[model samples]
Target: MELRWNPILETWVMVSAQRQRRPFMPKESCPFCPGSGKVPDQYDVYLYPNDFPHLMKDPPEPSIQDDDLLRVERAFGSCDVVLYSPDHTASITQLSREHLARLFELWRDHYRAMRERADVKYVLIFENKGDIIGVTIPHPHGQIYSYPYIPARPAKELDSARRYWESHGGACLFCAVLQKELAFEKRLIWTNEHFVAFLPSYADYPNEAHIYPRRHCGSLLDMSKAEAEDFMDGLQRQVRIYDSLFGFELPFMMGFHQEPVDGAEYPYFHFHVEFYPLHRSRDKIKYNAGSETSGGAFTNPSSPEENAEELRKINAEL
Candidate 1:
């Protein structure tokens, strides 16, 4: 496990061959179950260290020595899995709102724990659902990764937000985005008192949705008790819409975007959750092919308004 520097792209690529040897366990032998002997005998929610983590506290030296072009360093970080329920069949949508709020609290505490580490630069909380999304474990759960350095996508967002702040007299770029979405209103799917779920106008996927806090906040720690409850409500509704979209469990990738924990100032940064579902429609699946993977260009065949309207109709029924 080591970090290889990509000079052309200016990013650190994690090289962990151990992940290739991960064991795939079926539901009958699932380790995340209550009686599986891998976790506590009984618990509402559990936190288990990843058996095959991409990063760790003590990693071996790099495979190849450092050269003028190729730079290498140890992969020093941690990854852990947050099991949502001991019952093997309960999805996030089925979990009560109170349970989801507890999950959110667990994420916040874990983020705070990782932030205390001087080497940790970013803490990412994300979930992958459905077998098509590469989740072999059928159990409902999420994962947290503490990175030694900020990942590329979040770094780009921070850079853009910072530039916008500096140029616009400390105006926040994300807040501006939320306001624009609210003004358009066509892309909004659902909303509570404290949060809004909408498809961005610049969406790259057909059903891509984002949840943003109505009040400007940098991280989960900034959420009040009311905001926390409302956030979970928004999240649950978002997934409910996903499942109802095609009368089947839809596969999707959900991630939290927040300010870095490097102890620097990022007043312009905002907290949001982005969902990238693999389904383009009830019958079609959206795959990242040549344009997306090779050239970094995401092509959306459908308009965000039409897509959001579809979800809004579902929201109305729910």
Candidate 2:
């Protein structure tokens, strides 16, 4: 099995075809279980360096200098897992405000710790929820990954934002988008003094939502205590609304994008949260068939506007 870098596509393609045939179990013994060898049962939150890392801080072995046409560079980075709660049944959205705040505290701490490493430039925190998303463990947890190089999606966004900032004499692209959504209000779900959740006009999924700090903060790592508290409050409320919309505990992939932890500052970058759910309705699932995989196009069952309206109604009733 090998991983190849596709320079034209600007992505890493895992060349292991057998990986698609790997066995998956919904009830497998979780390696992250407390008192299961690595950690004790009394821990409410656990953070450990991953045994299988995509990148390591240590220098890599000599590269195989094949033909110049087929060059391969080592992708060095680290991956770690964060146990969100002691109770495996609880999800991030199900966490109490206090527990959620503690989680946020750890997030901030991890960001600082990873960024201090000279090899790490970008740090990403995200979660894949439910077995449908290929998450084997039922535990309420997420993963933290630190890369020596900026990731493709974030690098592209940063470039675009930097260009926009230069053109506008220092302006945030996301802040402008947030202003537009606030004025429109049709796509707005909820907001407080510090944060807002809204469905973007150019949403890629039926129920896609973006949560952002109202202030033009660079990243979650830089958020003040008050701002962090308000952000968590809005986050929990949004999750409840999502669950109510489907009349069940909703499943979604949530990720936070922040400025890279490297010493350089990104004045144009604004911290934000993105949630993309696979389900379009109670029974309908959004499957990314060949079109999405091969052509980079999407076909959503419901319009973003309609979905926003439905979400708004549910949020209000809740």
Candidate 3:
């Protein structure tokens, strides 16, 4: 089994065809099962390395630091699944604000701890909801992965921000985007003093939406407690809109972008959360297909402006 790294897209795609042979189970092996050796009820939070990893765990350390054309390494990182609730059936949307707030607090603590390690340079916190995204567990939870180097996507975003700062004399690029979108009022969904949720004009999905802060901030750790609360409120509201759009609980993969742990300033980087749902129509699904998978471009069936309009109307009616 070999994983091919596509330099064109800067994405490492696993080409292990044998993985398809893995058995399918009708029921999820609930990781949060009570008194189970893998998951205990006493743990509100826990961090550990992934039992199964695409990257090897014992690769040479110097290989990662090498700047040569060829690099190698053991997966000098960690992947920990977060158990968000004692009830396996509950999702974040169904969780109380208090539990969500504590989860946010735990996120901060995890990010800070991971950043302190010399080997780790980026902390990724994300959730993959629904079976469409291949979430093995039906339980409400997310995962935290600490990497030894910045991933390609974040690296690209950081470079984009840096270039924009250099060209615009330190003005934040996303701030400008938010300002212009708010003025346009076309793709705008809902916004408050602290955060704004909108569908971008260049959205690649039928109803993709993003939640970003009004003020420029490098990371979630930079946000004050009140600001974090506002973010959580905004997150819940945006998700509710998504659910309302289809009249069903929407499924999405949500992730956050924050400053790198390499100690470089990213003044132009504004923290945001993005959600990508696979559904395009009420009952139909959108496939990435050849164009998206090979061409690295997307063809959306609906316009962002229209999606925003519909979402806003639905939310208002709700």
**Ranking of all predicted structures according to TM-score, beginning with the best and ending with the worst:** 1, 2, 3
List model 1 lDDT by residue over 130-239, tens digit each: 88888979888999999999999999999999999999999999999999999999999998899999999999888899999999999999999999999988888899
lDDT of 1: 0.91
Steric clash count of candidate 1: 0
Of 1 and 2, which scores higher on lDDT?
1
Please give the range of 10 consecutive residues that has the lowest summed lDDT in model 3. 59-68
The true-versus-predicted C-alpha distance at residue 145 of model 2, in Å, is 1.2
For 1-318, candidate 3 gives per-residue lDDT tens digits of: 333445556654433344465444346555466665766657554553445543333433332242333333445656677777777776566767787788888888888887777767777888888888887667677887676678888888888988998999888888989899999998988887789888999888877888889878888888987788888878878778888877887888888888777665667788888888778978988889889988878899888898899988876775
Question: For each candidate, what TM-score against the reference?
Answer: 0.98, 0.90, 0.88
Q: lDDT values of the candidates?
A: 0.91, 0.80, 0.75
Error of 1 at 171 (Å): 0.6
Quote the RMSD, in angstroms, for model 1: 0.9
lDDT of 3: 0.75
Give the number of the best model, judged by TM-score.
1
Please report the candidate that would top lDDT against the real structure: 1
Per-residue accuracy of model 2 over 139-181 as CA lDDT, tens digit each: 7788998877777889988999999999998988989999999
